[model samples]
Target: MRSVLDRGLALYRQGEDLPAEELAKCTALAVQLAERGERIAPLLHAWDVGCSVAVAACWVSARPGEQSELVSLTQWSSVGVKEITAAISLAYVHAQKQAGLDTSRRVLADLMLNGSATDELAAAAHHSPAKEYVAVAGRVVGENVPSAATVARASAALTTGDLGLSCQAGRHLCILAPIRSHRSTEELSGHMVETLKRVGITFAAPAGAVIAPRSELAMAVQQASRIESLAGIAGLDGKTVESSQVISELAISRDGEYRRQLISLIDPIVEAPELLKTLRTLYLMDLDRSRTARRLNVARRTLTYRLERIEQLTGINPVRTRGILAFVLALAARDLDLSSSVPEGV
Candidate 1:
């Protein structure tokens, strides 16, 4: 298997028409080996099929008349050749700007609805070196197109820390990301983009769009804050959990006096304009001083000096393990508090 992967990769790196053909052959062979009751079959097959499809699609697109040959090549390549071949056919139609988009979309839709077994096969093929590549297929053809209300429901489900709902939301979002990107980013940001499209959200890569596990509570707080008609919105409101109150309680419960002490210690430094900017960047960059320095376009030593000054002014070491935790929580608190003050649904 290792030899098979090495051969395929080597062919890929060689970079020529012949190499592409040879790589396709090697990938097909890798897929065969993956299916021979190998434990890592899923991963190997994923890479094998992805590379083969990608290369063959490119080749066929460049030489549109060789459609039959492309079909034949894919048919002989693997057991699930029909689906792969269909993908190639669609890719060709898409490239040629032919009337096959609707046809291809319908085929894909059917495959997603009735092809769970194929998805599992693809998942198996996505097992190792191929895992990442196979996921591309799984994300594309396996995902269901959820509605906008489904997205909102999924978001709401996430509020309860229900892992299943979170997963459902994540999967739906992953699909939505790519569809949105197709109009915006490019043809190939892969499965991650697809997932986002399904969920109907666009996220810039550098924006760190991944929802942290711990952030679910924060999401719930944000959602609750959006109920304008809730009595909590009026000053004489009925009793309900204020989002800031929730955050403050959670923060205090997690750290007690240590949390408050840390906030007090850091507040004065944050009041200093220059120091606040540095700390803000540091937190945003997850305390990667080098990245913070890069974002600030300051020398690393200067960043260090700024951090040191923060610690000096506040009597708290930013680098200390406890200090870092406290700082992040404090920042979360500040964000929650500020968000709570905004009118609901804004």
Candidate 2:
């Protein structure tokens, strides 16, 4: 079994079309071995199936015009079983749509029932054919179907790859992407901490949160302790008190202070109070002055003047980092207090 897996991996590394086919064959053998009551590990079986599916997905994605043939081959081969079947059906539907097929409820139903109709399959089906599917899936899966405002917030976080913010916006349904840069983990973590604040996700980096390739579970616990110590110095409160925290109370407190300062700095420049109401709209629209002005039913020149006055009062450039930070803080603050004073318009 080990020899078969090694051979499969070697073939995959060859990176040729023939090698992909060979790998698929080996994966089938591995699956057969597992089903025959061999000592094959479930993880090994999973890997084999995943590799076969990935190779097939690559083939289809590379030659979209050949998707039908690929799908047929995958289905008949039973390479990745239900998963490959679903992929094939999804690819075919997408290809058909691109070719101007109607691709409505009928097509969706066909795809859903084509393979094992797991929850994901059903959810995908309902998304296309039925409005009620989303609500039902939301209830069953405990996924938060965020409001339009929350969607907007989540979209912004996704655009920037701000995982903590995305998770917060999506109500913990999102996972932060693993850091891939050459920067130290601590630095990357610090940046994540700051970004989470901007997006209003409260989390702590207890030792356990600082997982590394070589770090042991004990080391992780120690790291959590270090984070807790740091949090105490920062003067923050947390959802719970533990030796380890993913986010410290001090970080939350600092975020609150930063937000307050932002509002305090901006509140004096409101030559036109209505601009405050437009802040969220403007930020969502990516600070396009002309676009914001149009949305607010005001002239571009008037909008520019107000923005300039706001900059003068806040001493933060509307187009720069400080200004963007202030804008976000102000928006969050608005949600907390509608009757609060509008920042002075620049």
User: How do the residues 47-111 of candidate 2 rate in per-residue lDDT, one tens digit apiece?
Assistant: 44675765565575656476665555545345434444344344433444445432222233222
How high is the lDDT of residue 303 in model 2? 77
- TM-score on alpha carbons, each prediction: 0.30, 0.26
Best by lDDT: 2
Error of 1 at 114 (Å): 33
- Supply the global lDDT for candidate 2: 0.41
RMSD after CA superposition, every candidate: 19.7, 21.2
Would you list the C-alpha lDDT of every candidate in the order shown?
0.40, 0.41
Question: Which residues of candidate 1, in runs, are more than 4 Å off?
Answer: 1-262, 341-346
lDDT per residue (tens digit) for residues 161-259 in model 1 = 211112222222321121211221223223333344455543221111211122132243233323211212222122222334344434443454654
Write down the TM-score for model 1.
Answer: 0.30
The regions of model 2 sitting more than 4 angstroms off are 1-255, 269-272, 333-346
